[model samples]
Target: MTSELIAALRARLGDERVSTAESVREQHSHGEGHHAPSMPAAVVFAQSTDDVAQTLALCNAHRVPLAAFGAGTSLEGHVNPPEGGISLDLSRMTELLSVNPQDMDCRVQAGITRQALNQILRDTGLFFPVDPGGEATIGGMCATRASGTAAVRYGTIRENVLGLTAVLADGRVMRTGGRVRKSATGYDLTHLLIGSEGTLGVITEIQLRLHPIPETIAAAVVQFETLSDAVATAIDILQFGVPIGRLELLDEVQMDASIRYSGLTGLRALPTLFLEFVGGPEAVREQIAVVEAIVSDRGGLGFDWHTDPDQRAALWRARHHAYWACLAYRPGYSAMTTDAIVPISVLAELVAGVKEDIAESGLTAPIVGHVGDGNFHTIILVPPTPEGLAQAWALDRKIVRRALALGGSCSGEHGIGLGKREFMADEHDPVALEVMRGFKKTMDPNGILNPGKML
Candidate 1:
């Protein structure tokens, strides 16, 4: 049966596009996460929507599980196929389909990475703002509802995506929403698939809303004596309506790790806030003035702002390479990061409690966050052993439970892949989960589309 499936795929897409090689299977087996990798029987590099459609049709008929894979940068196991069937690779379907400058939107094949799309739009006086750090494909971002540094101002993929073309499990095609901004459409199916994480269907093309390049932009780094002071300043910025483009927080431990790894200069290893302000020059100045005052009031070190693009990038290098920095800081250890977000009113207290938890657990977990949005992550460091894995998960669960107790969620941006699947029942309403499973069953009844995930 495996040989038959491979032959059928090769006949349709040619042997160049179909692979049964051990190396190719290894590449498609998992995403960049802690989950154990599971190799598929075959990897099919899909080149077009028709290719995806035909492949799904054949797989559906054969009752073979199909997992859609893009750039394998997903933090959760979104690309992992634990059931082990066919891995549908979409990295080749990367053509820019259309762009409507008047509407500030563009259409591209799902495999286009955010960095590549922004480069393509560099001369268009507009840019895509969903920067989830790594070179994640837009399709994967849509699948996981990803957000990053710019989320405080530009919003997440859920808000920026205008529409998409998807292939259902039975090889049927459906187009949702369009170039026009607002529509009283039926059911809002566009959003329904945004964060489905490949359980419902495979996204092939995306229509994304773009933002104008900021006329003036500046970034600042403010050091705080304590975690409370740093978090309090972030909360004040949110409440003051400062329209910050990006607001990030890093605890002392993360700061130290990042500083050494990224070769950061002159910055102390203290809890700090990285803030970006964007607007007209005068407006940016006013925003900075307000934030500086807030930081001062909170007993923070003076706000040191940088306007040069290179300098701004340098200042943010530590935050961007945080994971690698943490690994370097603790040799022979792996870190399992947790995504816990809570209300702003309770963020300070929650962070203080997390510090206590980490200290009591005797673990070296560094903290970082998109504090403007009440979201934070902690990387629990442990040896790369079975006992270490168990310890990491235990602490992760404790942090998640604490966040939930404060009316927060177990995951803020990372979707419920293999890591957080068990927490879904606690994070959402039971009826909501029921409706979601119903949607999955209605869309992919045979359970061949990325089976054993998100439900």
Candidate 2:
């Protein structure tokens, strides 16, 4: 049967695009998640929307599970193919279809990465702002509804995506929404696929909204004596309407890990907030003054700001590398990062409680967050042992439950992929869960599209 399916794919796409090689199959079998390894039987390198449609048609007819492969950077095993079918990789489909500068939008193939798109638009004075820390494909980012530090001001992929072209489970090619924004039209199928994790359909092309490059930008690192103080300062800054472009918090443990991993620093390992302001020169200066005053009043130490592009990139690169730094703190161990978001008023209390929980559990987890949006993540390093893994999973569940109880979500940017499926019923009411299941069934009756994913 496997040979028959491979033969069909080869017939449709030719020998150059289809492969049954062990290395290629293994490469497409798993993503950067803690899930156990599982390899697919074959891999297909798709080069166009027609290629994706044809591949899905063949997989559907054969009753073989099909999974879309992006950059394989998903943290929740969203791209892992456990059923040993075919991995439809879109990496070869990287292409910029069109750029409409006047409309402030662009059409791109699903495999285009955020960094790649930004580099392509460097001379256009427009850029996409949804950064999910690691460089991820636009399709995968949209599938996960990913956001990052800049999401506080720029919003997530859910907000920036204007429209999409997707292949439904039955091999039907459909387009949702259009170049003109703001539609009150019927069901929002466009958004339905944004966080579906490729269960309902496979995205082939995307129309994304872009923002004008800011005229002036500045970043600052403000250190605090306590985690509570840092959170409190963040809340105050947001409440004062300071127009901060990015406001991130890093606890002492995270600071220590970062400094040790990056080396060469005179900085103390205290709780810190990395912030950025973007606007005109006068407006940015005003916002900076307000932020400085708030942090100083909250017992913050020397507040340093950078305006140079290289210096700004260096600071953010260090910030984006926090996950790696935390993992390095414990050699021979992987990380399971949990994300949650709460109201700004309750952020300080929740963070303080998390600190207590980590201390009581005796776990080596550091805290970091996009504080302006009241979203935070705890990067926990777990040794490759049954006991350690069990303990880490337990702590993660406890944190999610706590977040739910406090009117927060189990995940802020990371979607509910393989890891958080069980928590969906608890997070959303049973009625809402049923609605999601209904949508899943309506779109994918056979359940061949990324089976075992969300819902």
Please report, in order, the local distance difference test score of every candidate based on alpha carbons. 0.90, 0.89
Candidate 1 Cα deviation (angstroms), residue 300: 0.8
Q: What is the lDDT of candidate 2?
A: 0.89
Which candidate leads in lDDT?
1
Model 2 TM-score relative to the real fold: 0.98
Write model 2 residue lDDT over 1-455, tens digit each, in one string: 77788899999999989988888877887787788768888889999999999998888888899989889899888888878888889987789999999999999999999999999999999999998887799999988999988988899999999999999987899999898778998889899999989999999999999999999999988888888889999999999988889999999999999988866266779999999999999999999999888988999998899899987887888888898898889999889899888888888878888887888778789998898899999998887899988888888888888888888889888888788888788778889989989998898888899999887
For residues 337-368, write the lDDT of model 1, one tens digit per residue: 88899999999989999998998888899998
Per-model TM-score on C-alpha atoms = 0.98, 0.98
Model 1 weakest lDDT span, ten residues long: 1-10
Per-model root-mean-square deviation over C-alphas: 1.1, 1.2
